[model samples]
Target: MRSDPALIGPLLERIAAWRAGHAGLFVLGVCGAQGSGKSTLVATLAERLTQAGVAVAALSLDDLYRTHAERQALAREVHPLLATRGVPGTHDVALGLATIAALERGEAAALPRFDKAADDRVPRGEWPHAPANAQVLLLEGWCLGAKPQDTAALAAPVNDLEAREDPDGVWRVHVNAALEADYQRLFARLDRLLLLAAPGWDVVAGWREQQEAELRQIGGARVMNPAGVARFIQHYERLTRHILSEMPTRADLTVRLGPNREVLELMPGA
Candidate 1:
């Protein structure tokens, strides 16, 4: 109910149409910039859709990030930047695909959860078990439906994180290469994609600051300082900009938002 009816009504209609035509789970990918409220939107959609007699399950791509130790090893073997989460190469794409396969096969699946405080994945046994035979599955993330950028685009550093820490271009190139491979396999499973398009990258820092304040008030662990938010978001700047440019036309539905996160327009994908 917290989600706008303007967006949710049409999305529900699409889900119903998809559910009627195709059997089994319909993977609905929801893409939004950090702090753009995509998770809240998905929560509302899941609640509303279930009330209308649809069996729904929700999952976040962040839940599939590799463990802290795994990332440490990658940092040693690959590049130092691999140690930080949020980039494509840091996720365990095979696990994500496997979970989707299990759900599609009408089997109970373990839904992975990542602890942002711990900065690692919650153990498998501790994961919540999702029931089989779902009619719709919500797979949402900051870059869920993003396409890989051209190799040439990776050469220029988008921000200070790339300029100073990744002066050699190893991290961004690795991330783009990752998007080309397993991430595509993961994104390919989506039956529909909806983008919550932020007006521009300039708005993200303020929104992210809002998220941090809420988390601190709620005592969420590992919340970064306000200064840290600026530096941290730099890790996502490249693909996020890339998605802002590329995904609006490609997503099945696009909900354009103002700097204040208000809906500006809604349009069907090209």
Candidate 2:
């Protein structure tokens, strides 16, 4: 919904170039901090591509959230932090890989939709018809390609959210560990990577607050308050911080969003 063509134009240009050059299943990892407009960019690209007759399917990692009851059970047994979803472990990566693999093979696939209000995924049995001509798959999320920091540094104190539940940092530790081994396997599948370079936690906190406030006005009780937002940010702190630091070195291109959460710059990776 950004009015400025400065942001949209360059992104679309790159996407168009990539599509023109590659005929295989293209996976673009759209990564950013919470409320940093990653999904907005993804949707815009999908719309543009669809209009150009480049069949596109959009997939979000959020759709992979476990049922509420399942998360509660995980919190009690596996780790209370598991209830704090949005870190790397909250997703069914295997399912994601399978979904992508199927798309690569030109097959129609049914995908589950996650209900944020219910805090669980609904088995709506809805299937997205991947037309025989569909080409690009837009896979996006907070930790689409997140890797964790070093363990020795992991001993540092985390925010209250991490303390209240995952004091041991088990979720991130486990997630990063898995990512170190297999995430590259997945990343290699991407024809290109598009990163939404977000500001630090302080800036992310502001955007999250604004999002919650608007959500509150619109949906009444559905929106998470400032405290709830803080808790959610804590769950993503390590990875978010990681993205801010590591993405410049890892991504093919980067778009820095300003404190106002607007696209500040779109530039090549460092």
Candidate 3:
């Protein structure tokens, strides 16, 4: 999908206003549900900022996923579901923290990249280098700044995936614990967070399905079929819904989107 100038214009204005209040290496977090266009918005914003003479580096949480071997070990030690890459417990939180720290310190750092098609991280030699003097860092992710659900919320199954795979709630509890601990430390680095709020969780599967379709057209190995897409999204459903219910008020700015993915309203964080 193309970038929406109508939406980007207002967002750029707000970001400029937000940047003015902060000094020295601003960290902006862009959060959204699957297929909500977080990467598109971040890319457009980074391009605009670069044209304005700012040194910007954009990173996706997807790139910080644990290596395949690491995740396999997690699966062996933790739960079988930990083998999946999309959830909180599957990320390399320490690496994320180190990357942000290095950037803030104006040190040259090589950012890691994950090869989703291969289900592993690319070699360090293949990684991209972020400039030492970046003025702004844009970190985008599906679950960035997502708060953990309470114990009561985890007692019930949200879908068949949860009901069958996580019947005892082991996986959900593990994911929530990661959110409360390591993820919280990582998110605290954000000076401002912009959330692309989907209309509701019900639309996420359709949006993700559309994304997989596009990927398939391009012959992407990671592209999932319709049924696979449905099952895959179940891993994200709980936190995505929690962010929908919680992050709008907590984020520095939130761009609400309708079913058609058009910007509906922009709300300032509380």
RMSD of each: 1.3, 2.1, 1.3
lDDT of each: 0.88, 0.74, 0.89
Taking all chains together, each candidate's TM-score versus the true structure is 0.96, 0.91, 0.96
| Model 3 C-alpha lDDT per residue in residues 1-270, reported as the tens digit of each score | 246776788777887888896878899999999999888888888888899888888899999999999999999998999999999999999999999888988877788899988999999999888877888999999999888899899999999999999999999999999999999999999888889999999998789989999998999886788899889989999889888998888888888889889987888878
Question: Candidate 3 local accuracy as lDDT?
Answer: 0.89
Better of 1 and 2 by TM-score: 1
Ranking by lDDT: 3, 1, 2
> Model 1 Cα displacement at 114 (Å)?
0.9
Per-residue lDDT tens digits for candidate 1, residues 1-270, read 256777778778877876677877889999999988899999998899878777788899999999999999999998998999999999999999999998998877889999988898887889987667877889999989788898888888989889999998988888889989999999989999999999888897678888898898988878888889889889898988899998887888889998888877888888
Clashing pairs in 1: none
Ten-residue stretch with the least lDDT total in model 3 = 1-10
Cα TM-score of candidate 3 = 0.96
User: Alpha-carbon error at 153 in model 3, in Å?
Assistant: 1.0
**Alpha-carbon deviation at 74 in model 1, angstroms:** 1.1
